[model samples]
Structure formats: C-alpha cells, structure tokens
Target: GGSIKHDISVPVSRMADFIAQASEAVTARLPGIRPVPFGHIGDGNIHFNLSQPVGMDKSEFLALWGEMNAIVHGIVRGMGGSISAEHGVGQLKRDEIAATKSPVEMAMMRALKQALDPKGILNPGKVV
Candidate 1:
C-alpha cells in the first residue's frame, strides 16, 4: 500500500464547502482511491492523504501523484485556497505554483531570488 499526501488551506467559513468539493472531485476522478482527509479545521488547513486501493499496484498508484495533485489542487485553488499550506513550496510544488501564479508574481519572485541570491547559492533550484 502507498500513500499520497497533500495540504490545502481555505477560509474558515468555507471549510465545509471546500472539503465537500475536494472529496467529490477526488472521488469523481479516482473512484478506487480512498481519501483520508484530516487536519486543523480551526484554521481551515487540511492534510488530505490518499491510500492505494486493495490489490492495487504500488507503482501504478504512486504514479497518480501528479494527477491527484492537479485534481485536488485545482479544487483548492478554485475555492480560493492555497495549494501549499504550512509547508513552503519545494521542488515537489515548484511547477504547480509557477502554473498557478500570475506572470507578474512569478517575475517578482524571480527578481527577489536573483537579488538576494545572485549566484543561486541558497537552496539552489528549490523555490522560484
């Protein structure tokens, strides 16, 4: 059995709606996978995890990581929630953030990175 983990944060008021939408989206796209969502609802952050179905191939299930991220993160984004909650973006979410962020925002981030770490010495190729 393998597991996929994702974290998202939405407004406290919309926590219930976000959870419903997210669950529906995941189940609709991946009927066989069982989503085990849990976290601090007080702040509206959810640590959504998925477990591979019975008799499912580990590699095959793990291969859905990116696809699941897209499905789940899309729902989170549409609900005005952050794709990365608590955990800062790393290589795992670099492309997702780039795709989700605006061009101007991306440019500003790059500028800041370049200005602060001209040689890309700090955490090279991690974020931005």
Candidate 2:
C-alpha cells in the first residue's frame, strides 16, 4: 500500500553487490517484497524503494519498516557506504547514524559539533 524509501550510496565498485545483496536480504525476510533500486549510478546513489506485496494489509506491511531498514542499512554499512546519501538523516535514522559510528569517529564528531555549536543551540541533539 505504501513504500519505504532508502537514500543510500556505496562505492562504485560495490553498487552491483549492494543491490543484489539488499534485494536478496529483503526478499528472504518477506517474500514478494519488491525491491526498487534506481538512482544516479554515477554517484553511487540508489533510491532503494520497497513496495508492499500484493494482497497484504497496508498496516501489516508497514510494520516491517524498522526491520527492513536494518536489513538494508546493514548491507550499506558492510559495504563502507553512507546510509544517508541524499536527503539528510531524519528521525528514522538519526539514532542509527550515531550507533553505527566507531567510538573514535563518534568522539571526533562530538568534538567538531562542540566547536561548531558551543551552546548546543543549532538543531540541538539532532546529530551524533
């Protein structure tokens, strides 16, 4: 009934693998799940969209949003890719973005954030 959209990017070398692996992963999780991978190939950005299977209840299909995100994002991470390739990381992925970063990377990111917003006024706590 509705779709879950992923704005992800991987290295050019891994584009094909990303698509294949993600598609296979989701299909295994929910048979009949349609994996729509399309976008700027040159930039390694694939707007991975998932359409619910036919005859399924809309709410039932939508309930798998988080699980599907985990499935696809895991592949993206394994490929050394960005989960947010185009649109900024919104509420759906804000926590995930931070959780996936290494401690060192998180520390560096916090240092930079501190430098940029000493008072924590700008989009306070919106990013890692």
Candidate 3:
C-alpha cells in the first residue's frame, strides 16, 4: 500500500519504444532491480512500478524518487506523453500539469468545473 503510483500515458505509436527505453534506463542507473512494468498499452499508459532490489532498504530505495521520476518522465514527455494520465491531479502534480497544458484547454476545463460547482465549494483546488 505504500508503493508510489504514476499514471502516465504516451502516444500509441511510441508505447513500445517508451517502455523499452525507460525500463532500460532505470535498470541501468539502479542495478539489480526488477521493474514491474504493467498498464494499458492500448492507451499507452504503463504503471512502471519498481520494487527494491533484493536485500535493499525500502527507505534508501524510495529516496531515488526525484531522480527516477526525472528519468522516466523525461523520456515519456520526449515522446509526447502525459506524465499524469487517467489519475486526476492531486497535490503531487497540480502545478506540473497546469504548466504544461495549453491555455485554451485549461480554460475549458475550468469552465466545466465552474459550471458543475458554481459555489466553488465542491472539491475546490482538487481537480481544476
């Protein structure tokens, strides 16, 4: 239950390539590890989960989040993928998504949010 999850997506054409390249990079940097790469390939979103190398400390293993995220997401974005796929934005990726999405798209999303929640009290600052 303590595992971190990143719901990322890539273009259909680049799905296989992204998985191969990303898995290769992560393993190269962190040896003796097995990446549990599994997700929706049709939509190009792979839940690239990594378990600690045998006998490795969990805390020490998790301390590599920043570096691992940068490496994985960098490849995903380089291939035109959204680092946050089906999983709606939370505190972790709110600013990151906002910075990348276009103004028009963001405006439309906000309009929809306001329409459904006119009082701005329903889950405010959660999705929009």
Which candidate's lDDT is highest?
2
RMSD of 3: 2.2
Q: lDDT ranking from best to worst?
A: 2, 1, 3
lDDT digits (tens) for residues 1-128 of candidate 3 = 12445678988898889879988998999896667778887878788777777877888888887788788888877988887877766667777777667888778877887899889898778655
Q: Which of the numbered candidates is closest to the native, going by highest TM-score?
A: 3
Candidate 3 clashing pairs, residues 3+ apart or interchain: none
Residue 83: error of model 3 in Å?
0.7
TM-score of each: 0.80, 0.82, 0.83
Mark the 10 consecutive residues where model 3 has the least summed lDDT: 1-10
lDDT of each: 0.84, 0.88, 0.78
Tell me the number of clashing residue pairs for each predicted model.
0, 0, 0
In angstroms, give how far residue 98 of model 1 lies from its true place. 2.0
What root-mean-square deviation over C-alphas does model 1 reach?
2.4
Q: What is every candidate's alpha-carbon RMSD to the true fold?
A: 2.4, 2.4, 2.2
lDDT of 2 by residue, 17-53 (tens): 9999999999999999999999998999999999999
Q: After superposition, how far is residue 72 of candidate 3 from its true place, in Å?
A: 1.1
Error at 88, model 1, angstroms? 0.5
**lDDT (Cα, tens digit) per residue for candidate 1, span 10-127:** 8889888877887788778777888888999899899988888788899999999989888888888887888888875778888889777789977887888889889999879866
